[model samples]
Target: MCLAIPMRVIAVDASGLSATCEAKGQQRQVGLIMLDEVVRIGDYLMISLGQAMQKISVEDAKQTWAYYEEILNFSPSH
Candidate 1:
């Protein structure tokens, strides 16, 4: 299964074709071509394959991250 990461927009290019996003203290440039709305700084986006697929609310982003963290921190009983 493919996982889409939640990242916050840090910066956007002048043409608005791409943006710089950060998550877990890591930063990456992702294409914004999939979105039709304005992508402002601090906006949370669902990123996949080096592209921002959709804009998500802050609460949604936080909840997703919480789930991710839980999975990442999980320990098997084996």
Candidate 2:
């Protein structure tokens, strides 16, 4: 099973095809191939398979973050 996780864009290259995204304070560089339009810094995106799958609204980002927090809080610790 796989999932496209939500992440926030932190930086975009001048070409507009690639960006740096942050999730849970971790950063990753991903390609914006599935984006419907050009992406910019501060945009929230859903990423999978090294590609950005979709752009997300601020409200959605907040909801997703809340879900993540809940999951993390309940996760078993080693």
Candidate 3:
């Protein structure tokens, strides 16, 4: 299964073909060619493999991040 992280768009290039996204205090350039809608700053995107898969609602993004945090904090007794 592939995991996609939710990131907020921080910047977009002049051509709109790429954007800088931030999540968990990290930033990365992600391709926007895969998305069908117009991307703008402050928009949340579902990111995977250096690409923006799609636009996601702010609430959805928050929920997904919360789930990720929960997984990261989980500890298994060995």
Across 1-78, the per-residue lDDT of candidate 1 in tens digits comes to 889999999999999999999999999999999999999999999999999999999999999999999999999998
User: Candidate 1 — which residues are off by over 4 angstroms?
Assistant: none
Question: Clashing pairs in model 2?
Answer: none
Instruction: Please give, for residues 1-78, the per-residue lDDT of candidate 3 as tens digits.
Output: 889999999999999999999998999999999998999999999999999999999999999989999999999999
Predicted structure 3: lDDT: 0.96
Q: In candidate 3, how many clashes are counted?
A: 0
lDDT of 2 by residue, 1-78 (tens): 776788999999988889999988899999986677988889999888889999999899789878877987896769
Clash list (residue pairs), candidate 3: none
TM-scores of the models, in the given order?
0.94, 0.80, 0.92
Better of 2 and 3 by TM-score: 3
If ranked by lDDT, best first, what sequence of candidates would result? 1, 3, 2
| lDDT for position 47 in model 2 | 85
Poorly placed runs, candidate 3 (over 4 Å): none
